[model samples]
Target: SERIFENEKVTVDTIPLSHRVYTNGFLFREKPKELGLNVDAVKKYGIDISHYHNIKKGKDVLLDDGSLIPNSELTFPPQKVKSYAFCSDTAYEPGIIPFVSDADVMYHDATFLENEKHLAEKTGHSTAIEAAKIAKEAQVGQLILGHFSTRYTNTDQFLEEALTEFQNTSLARDGKVFEW
Candidate 1:
C-alpha cells in the first residue's frame, strides 16, 4: 500500500490489486472536519467573525471582558469521518480487505456474473458474488458494482448474486453520484 495524497480535507491511499497487469486500488478517507459553528451560541455570546476560526478549531472563546466560553458551548462536534474505496479490474483478492475495511462506500470490479467464473478468472476479474464477499468481509457500508463486460445485458442476476452476501449493494450506472 502507498499513501498517494494527503491534505486537510482528505487522504488517498493505494493498495495493490490482483490483475493480469499491475493494478492499484484507491482508498479515500476524509479527515475529521472542524466542528460546526453554533450560530445561536455565537449570537448569544456576541462573538465576532474573527473568532470563528478558533472556535471551530475547538478552542475556547475568551470574551473581551475576560470570561472564557468552553468550546463545547461554542460549536457542535465534528461529524463522522467518511471513507471510500475504488477497486477495479482485479480478481477477488483478500489482501485488499484491510485497506477497504469499514469504508462508507466501495466501488469494485464486478465484471461477470456468478455463472461466468471461468471467464472472470481468465480475465482477472471478479464475479458479483466474489465482489460482495469482499465487501461483506471488509464490512463496508455500501457496495457499488461496476466495470461490467459487454457480454452481459440484464444486471438483475448480478445484483441478486451480490445481494446474497452484501445487502447494501448497487449497480453502478453512468452519471450516478453516490455520497457518504
Candidate 2:
C-alpha cells in the first residue's frame, strides 16, 4: 500500500486519450487505488483502470507474534505498470524495493552526492549512491534520478555515484521522455 504521511499532497486523475490512467505524486503514497481507474481522465484519454487493483483496508494485519503479518487484508496485484516513477525527495528506504522491483522503468530521487549524505538524511532525503542501491535491489530495467537540491551545481558526481551500484541509472531533466 502507498503510505502517505501527513502534509503530503497526493492526487490522482485520468488523462486524455489513454487506455491507462497516469499517476503523478510524491513517492511516499501508494497508487494502486488510482492506477488503471476508469475515470473522467481515462474516458477523455480512452484509457481503462480495469486492470488496476482497487484499494482495501487491512484487518488484523499484524500477527500476535508481531514478527509475522497475517494476510494483508489490503493488497493489489501489480498491474501492467509498464513504467513506474517515484518522485520528489526521500531518504534511504529498503522497504520500497519490493513495490518497485521489476518495474519496466523506475525513477528515484537522488538529491545529493555522497559528501552531502548527512545533510540529505537530516532533511529526509537521499544521496545519489543510496538511490542507486534501491534501484539495484529493485532490479528495474531503467532508473532515472531527479529532485536535485539547489546547492548541486553539477550532476556528474551524482551520476558517478549511482553508476557504481546501478549501471542503468540516469538523471532526469524537467521535460525528458522515454517511450516504452
Candidate 3:
C-alpha cells in the first residue's frame, strides 16, 4: 500500500511494506528540473540566448563567430537525480522489491541477527541476513540496516552478517551521513 502527497514544492509517498500493525515507510523525491550552463564555455564560445534552450537539451550551439560549440563544452551535464528508499519496521517481504529496485540507497530494518530470526518474525521485523537478501534482490546501490534490536550489543555482527549477502550493507547509526 502507498499514499502520495503532492503540491507545487514536493511529493512525499508513504509505502506500506511492513507486516507490523500501523507501520509504513517513506520515500522523498525532488521535483524541480533545471539545466546548468557552463558560464566559462558560454563566454568562450560567445553563445547567445537563442541557443540556451538547445544547449540545455544537449544540442550543439552555433556561435556568432561562425564556430560550433559542442553541447559538452557549453553546458554541464545534468545533475544525476537520486532516489532513496526507507524500509524500516518491515518483515522479509519480497513484495517491496519492485518498489525499491535500483534505488541509490535503501534503509531496511535489521532488527535481529540470523540466530534470532524467530523473534524477528514474531515481531514482524527482519534479521540482518533477511535485510541483506532484500537489498540484493532489489539491486540497491547501498543497503543501510537500522532499527536494531537491543538484544545485540556489538552491532558489528549485524554488519558482518549483512555483508555476507550484500557487500554494500552498512549499519545505520546516529549522525551517520551517506553520500551518493
TM-score leader = 1
- Arrange candidates by lDDT, descending: 1, 3, 2
lDDT tens digits, residue span 1-180, model 1: 999899989999997899999999999999989999999999999999999999998899889999999999988889989999999999989899999999999999999998889999998999999999999999999999999888888877789999999999999998988866
Q: For candidate 1, what is the lDDT?
A: 0.93
Query: What are the per-model C-alpha RMSD values against the true structure?
Result: 1.7, 15.3, 3.1
* Model 2 residue 104 lDDT score: 65
State how far residue 54 of model 3 sits from its true place (Å): 6.9
Candidate 2 — worst ten consecutive residues by lDDT sum? 12-21
lDDT of 3 by residue, 14-103 (tens): 767767697778776555555688888787766777778878877887656677777877777667667788988998989888878887
TM-scores for all candidates?
Answer: 0.91, 0.56, 0.81
For candidate 2, write residues 38-155 as lDDT tens digits: 2343244332343223222322233234633322323433354344546445677776676666766767768778998888777767788888898888788888888888887887
Candidate 2 segments whose C-alpha is farther than 4 A from its true place: 2-81
Candidate 2 matches the true fold with a TM-score of 0.56
Better of 2 and 3 by lDDT: 3
* Model 3 clashing residue pairs (backbone): none
Best by lDDT: 1
